[model samples]
Target: MSENGGGTARRRRRGSATVAARTGVAPNSGDILWEIFLRLPPQPSSLPRVSLVCKRWRRLAADPEFLIRFRAHHRKAPLLGLFKEYGGWVSFTPVLGAPDRIPRRRFSMRIDYGGGAETHPFHGTLLGCRHGRVLAVDPRRREVLVCDPITGDQRRVALPPEFGTCGGAHGAVLCADGDEGHVHGGCHSSPFKVVLVQISFGPGHPPPFARVYSSETGVWSDPILAAEGSRGYVDLSRPSTLIGNSLYWWLHGSYLCNMEILEFDVGRQSLAVINSLPVGDTVKSKGCIQIIQPEDGRVGFAMLSYPSLEMWDLKDDCGGGVAAWVPRKTMNLDLVPNMRVTEASIVGYAEDDDAILIKFNNNIFIVQLESMQSRKLYDCFVRHQYHPFASFYSSGSAKRKA
Candidate 1:
């Protein structure tokens, strides 16, 4: 019986070799090849080049289930570049090098900032990006454009009439799918929601409100007022930080006013105001403040005071009804080579990457929060809004149907 079993195993091995030579693929190698391809870097060009290897490889690479597995294997999307709006034109600055660096022209969009006589003079604002889509407001057209930087697909959704004359506006784009297990890096085809928060500074205008637009419904919902008509100034210059189902924006304050946080709950479709950070007098002078989500995925606050960065986390109370900010670790960035931290401000935050884009002394630098490593991206003296664009993009993946 042992001799018979040994002969049978040898015959099976020989059979596999014969099949491999005939079809150019080893028996059961497809499963192994699938696993190997799943480990490829989540870059836009990764799968396309893999598809070029051969027809079988191309078939496997284009498999929708394989694409989903590839995205799930690498949970977080690669930070391909940063988007900034300047002179009514939104441009993309690639953060990666060579093969991973997406060209600027591929994602660039020219805002029709009411150049024609019939259109209003209101300029478009590049609000923020999430799940591979960019949200921008074109008030002149009374509509918001949802742009897919990967495929260059743009969907124009008209805003509610009340938001037509808003003093200032800041918006957030997110995938509408509420599945917790759903991977977001490649959500090009997923339904999404656009939350537009209106800012009013003058009298007689309607109080600040938020209106949500759902792609599933193809229309905007009724305006949701902030809790008890909470009158707080939203810092439109800074992008919002999304923690859990809530989106947070830093509220700027005047000399007599204290800064606060604006919270928008996507699930409840409600807006509320959170109290100001208990930064205390340690920060005698306010530098650049940004709302950041820390490594634990909790709501966090970061205040950059020239050389040092102070981090804070929101801790829930015993009953969980109220939350308070707790001081976290502070890192000194003065060790950044060759540049004096004379003028420093955080331009953008890459939530998944755990990094922030800092504008220091007319040079843009990307500083990793955990590693504390820094690298200067470029130099720019002009003022612009930067939104970090991170997504799992593939040129061929978009063209192929799932």
Candidate 2:
């Protein structure tokens, strides 16, 4: 009886080991592993940590096809932080905490003027951020840089002679590959285009012109001038908004109350001005206006006046032209009894989340328009144009410190 029991116990142990080996090999299968990794949380460190699991895991995490599928599985890229430029030095403020809280220094870039006869007169200006690239202008050098904040990679595009000595140049960087099924935020390896708009105020200078630079073709298109006799200058401090195929910038007219919308149609390669203010001129003059796309996904603007926040969406006529600004919704900040609202100012808008960043009492808070939910992000003492940097960072170029 004792010998039989011993033999039975050995048989059971062999069966358990066989099952363990089968399960282990099954999880490591290409399809199974790929599916498992694709479901990982959409965070900056998600892939990096997975890569550390083993050599095979590392290779799978860095695979190009797998990376594309991983990003597509997660449509919306996570908002990592905000980029603010001061004195030619761009700094990043991390908004998320813990594993996603990228160190501010990781994304900071100090613009080098490269002392020369053609050195830029002023420091670099942070124009905008999109698809994981930050756009900045080297005015003295008469060039623009498309920089990847995550990998510290930069491609310099020399400015056209027509843009030389131009005043207040603002531009945007975007993926040049017009793939309708392509996902943005992770377009680090794709070709890109730089759309630069320069406004020259004095006579004998060309009217406001916008030029497009294509990376694939390695050339700039003919100057697309603004509408004949278009008068106004864009605020270098304000960022550009890209809605659909058009890019919008707030064009400030001669008078304080004169504010207009500057539109650059990427599809037609045309520039025009929309002369209208959704709210009263008082809010515009006070610099409380921000271009936004509400939940309904229409081009709009948000105005903040102390405790009250008003939003409006631009209605487009069937003729494919901007019709009017329709009121959307209003939120009263006074509802939060614990808050002391001394003064409020509009800082920027996060188009991905349909939220607006508001600064009040030296603190910055992101208020979502849909739910009217507000959450304090950072303690900002000074005013800076906050550019939302959202992306699905990969482990291949992971540079964040532990």
How many residue pairs clash (N, CA or C atoms closer than 3 angstroms) in each of the candidate models, in the order given? 0, 2
True-vs-predicted CA distance for residue 153, candidate 1, Å:
1.6
Clashing pairs in 1: none
- Give the per-residue Cα lDDT of candidate 2 at 287: 60
lDDT of 1 at 139: 59
lDDT of 1 by residue, 1-402 (tens): 999999999999878755543333434555688768878888778888988989999998886666766777788988888888777667788978777777776666643334542422224777888888888877567778898867656688877777763346788999987765578868887999999887654345555679888999998888888754334566655788888889888765553136677789899888876665676554543346677775553578777876788888877762556776777888988646675556677788887766778888788888888888988877889756688888888776443212
Where's the lowest-lDDT run of ten residues in candidate 1?
Answer: 113-122
Any runs in candidate 1 off by more than 4 Å, and if so which? 1-30, 110-123, 201-207, 229-231, 280-287, 294-298, 318-322, 398-402
Q: Give candidate 1's total backbone clashes.
A: 0
Error of 2 at 242 (Å): 0.6
TM-score, per-candidate, Cα-based? 0.82, 0.82
User: Poorest 10 consecutive residues of model 2 by lDDT?
Assistant: 20-29
